[model samples]
Target: MKKIMFTGGGSAGHVTANLALIPYFRQENWSIHYIGSVSGIERKLIEELPDVRYWPISTGKLRRYLDWNNVKDPFKVVGGLLQAYRIIRKEKPNVVFSKGGFVSVPVVIGAWLNRVPVLIHESDMTPGLANRIALPFASGICTTFPETTKSTTPGKSRYIGPVIRDELLQGKAERGRELCGFRRDKPVLLIMGGSLGARRINEAIRKQLSPLTSRFQIVHLCGKGGVETKLESNNYRQFEYVNDELPHLLASADMVISRAGSNSIFEFLALRKPMLLIPLTKGQSRGDQILNAESFRKLGYAEVLPEEQLTPDSLLERTMDLYGNRERYKETMKAFDPGNGIKQIRDWITTIMK
Candidate 1:
């Protein structure tokens, strides 16, 4: 059996995507092991998978600033490199796949130095700093957006679209609506801020709850670590997080309002749900969210709302416009092919092993 190692962590989306590809690997009878940081959300999720062994490594942020903490980052990176070297030497995998986050950086470097074949998947229009830094050493780079091609180093890139799990592909939308207690004839609204949840988005939703709940049933995913629903109503259903139920909720929604995180945006695209995007604006994350949202909007797939001007009233108006013109959005989704990306990645792994 070929030994395959996978590295990526930080968020549920990336971790779940890694887990989703497990069946494909198993069917081919490959021996698979996962490596991630003990600090990330992967620790909680990866422990549940059967027959998959996991190892932990210390990782550090590649801060984009020149500050006191930035001085400490290199030390963290060095320590992580040492840890990753030990992992690669012990496991001796034929290939390593990365989902592109800060934690994956040291593993990428270690794998490359050890002559391990590395494949990277960057799920955004603008690749993350970790992936960009790892690009020069990657044997192959897979992207979810066509626009991402420009951001990568030339000669080692492919466009395979988004890799959505089977659940989202075959899930019943109407069943999700019913589960949320939504009317069969009326449309449903789905709001997600990602695994950690978005406080600002939740706040806006709270303000608009009265009006939104009146016409549409709402499925809101509050960030697991953030605020809970303060308002209670029959038309609104809330979850701290949805690991298994995401597909049902995505399938059931007529429209979605969310932050333009790369993973969440692609999930909407896979479901072909019309969306209004509110990109993140605060903190150290910078303008990457806005860039991704704008790129998708330019493709006519979704509408962009920079957080500066994203008020509850404006959001409501934009959502109403999409609701009134649902046919156009449906047509947009029909033009997209959501399958085969993950399969392509799986095939590439098999080819490399041979």
Candidate 2:
């Protein structure tokens, strides 16, 4: 049996992409193993799935600036790499795939050192630092945007779009409404700040609650650390997280207010939902999300809001504007969707084995 090891973590962005690969991997009878940090949010989601083994690694964050915290990162990385190496040796996988994140570095490095063919799927328009360093060593690199190819050397990179779950590709709107107990008579708006949640976006929405609730029925997936208080009106349902019923909520929505994470963008595109995207900028990866937002906005797919400009008034205005011009917004984004990527990814992997 062909064996493969996968690594990525931190948010649902990383975890969802990994989930996209599992069904296809299993059908081919490939033995699969996962390597992620013990404390990563992804652990809880994928742990119960059978035939998949999860390995924990000691992960450390790499600060973008010079700081005392930088001193301890190398040690942590070394330890994680050692743990990854042990898992790789024991599993003896034929290949390794990584969705770039801090948790993935050690696994990527371990696979490279062991001479295993390693492939990386990068989800942002601007590749992360770990991805930038790992690209030259990876046997193949897949990205979600055309602009991303410029960051890496040619011949090794290809654009495969974002990897999204199968349910989003099918119709999700009707089911989303049913699951949330929302009425289809009114417009449904989805507010998401990734899996862990975004404080700024949540706060802005909170400030505008009175006006927003009056106009729309909303489903807010606030990050785990978000304020979980109700708006006390009949128009909204708040959750620290929602895992099982995303397709319904996304498909049933008239509009979405979300972060410009690559994974989130693909979800909107798959469902063809009009969106107002707020890219992270405050100590958020040195304009990484800013680049993702800019790329999509340039294509007329979504409106981009920088962190400094994301106030209640700004969000409300943009929300109303997009809601008013729904036809033009939908027309402008006709070419942005890249159908479900699972079959494409599955084909690519099987080709390698052949």
Candidate 3:
């Protein structure tokens, strides 16, 4: 049988594309393996798949700010590098595919050291730190944004657009309504702060819940530990995180308020849901989300509210504006061409393997 190895982790954004692609490899009867940090979310997600083998290795966080851990992290990355090298040599996969993240850096280098071809996927408008370091070692790079090619090696980059999970397109609005105990009289507004949740976003949403719910039924996906049990209303629902039910929830939403992670914004785009984007501040992130939000806004797909200026009042105003202009946003989104990302990347992998 053919074989393939995948690596990426730290956040859901990093691993979700890999999740979307894994089943295709399975159908082709490839022996699939995943390498990620031992305690990262990737381990839990990949382990849930029965056929794919998971391998854990030491990994250090690639942080932009100074922390005590920064002093010790280089050692961890070196340790991960050695472990990944051994795994790549033994497994001898046809090629390694990476969705860029801190954990992926070592695996990419390991594959290069083992004389194996590696392909990388960069989900942001500009490459993240991990992907920047891995660029020279990769045989090819797949980008979700057309503009990202300018930042990559001249001949190695291909713009494949965003890869969306097929199941997301198969959701039923009525089923979502039933799951959320929502009535159809009001349009549903979905609020997502990302996998870890956005504290400021959550707090602002809660403070304006009464006004928000008066106009639209609300589904709030609070990150883990972000939910408030004492706060409940007939028109409002809160979830810490969702998996199987996400498709339905998304299907029911007429609009979305979310952080501007590239993977998530693209999913929202694919669903044609008008959005109000609140990107993470430069202090909090490397400013990728800010760029992601601006691109969407420029394309008329969403409105942006910078995190620095975020307040309950501003959020309410922006959301109301998004609702008022929903049709226009949807029309622009309809004109967008979300290329066949999965097919293109799969074809690339097959060609490289040969």
Candidate 4:
């Protein structure tokens, strides 16, 4: 049987792109295997899939800052590479497709050692530290942004666009309204803080919830451990996380307040949702999100409210502004092509195998 292995994980964003591509591989009857850390979110998401085998490997953080762990992480990476090499040797997959993360570096190197072709996907405007280190070993790197290609060796990177989960596009607005138990009198504003939740966003939204509630019905996906059950209102619904209903919630939303992650931004583009993006500032991240938000703003796909400028008043003002300018964004998003790369990615995998 035809076979392929996939590896990536640190956040849900890393694993989700791989999840979007899995159904096509199954339809073609390719055997699938995945390598990830045992405790990572990827292991939690991948282990239960029916046909795909999940293998756990040890991995270390690729921190950009110096810490005491920095002294010891190199040894952990070496150990992970050894474990990945053994796993690849036994599985003997025809090719390896990597969604970039620290866990993926070992897997990419191990696949190269086995003489298996490797393809990598990068979701930021510029490659992350993990992808940068894995670049030389990759056969071809697929990117969500064309600007990312300039940072890599010519011809090594291709703009394949973003991989969006099929379920997201199939959301039903009626179902979302029913689940949230709200009438359609006011427009819905969905606030997403990613998997780990954004403490600052959660606090700011709540501080201004009274005014926001007057203007719009609010649906908040506040991430795990970030919920306020005490304060309830007819116009507001709070969820720790929504799995099956996320699509419905998204479909019902007229506007979104979210972190500027590329996967989420591209999905919003496909859904034609007007958005006010709040990016993690350079202090908190390597500034990829700052770049992602800027690109979206530049293309008129969304509006940006930098993290430092994020006060309760500013958040509400920007959201209102985005909603007021909603039609322009909708028209622009229609023209914006965040290409669906599933077919192209699978085609690359097939061609490399042959």
Strongest candidate by TM-score: 3
Compose the digit string of candidate 1's lDDT tens values, residues 123-182: 877788888899887898888888788778887888888787777777788778867777
TM-score between candidate 1 and the true structure: 0.93
Lowest lDDT 10-residue stretch of candidate 4: 345-354
- lDDT of each residue in 1-354, candidate 2, tens digit only: 899888888777877788888877888898889999888876777786789988988998867888886999889999999999888888888888888888888898888888887888888887888887777768877878877888887888878877878766666677788766788798888899988788888888889988888788989998785756646445888878876677767778898988888888877876677888898884776677888788878777888778789888998989998888777768877766675566666666656531
TM-score rank, highest first?
Answer: 3, 4, 2, 1
Candidate 3 Cα deviation (angstroms), residue 350: 1.2
Candidate 4 residues lying further than 4 Å off, grouped into runs, are none
For all predictions, the C-alpha RMSD in Å is: 2.1, 1.9, 0.9, 1.2
Candidate 3 at 192: error in angstroms? Answer: 0.6
TM-scores of the candidates are 0.93, 0.94, 0.98, 0.97
Query: In model 3, which runs have C-alpha deviations exceeding 4 angstroms?
Result: none
Q: 3 or 4, which is superior by lDDT? A: 3
lDDT of 1: 0.81
What is the alpha-carbon lDDT for the whole of candidate 3? 0.94
Residues 11-127, model 4: lDDT tens digits? 988888898988888888999999999799899888767799999998999997879999998998999999999999998999999998899999999999999999999999999
lDDT of 4 at 213: 92
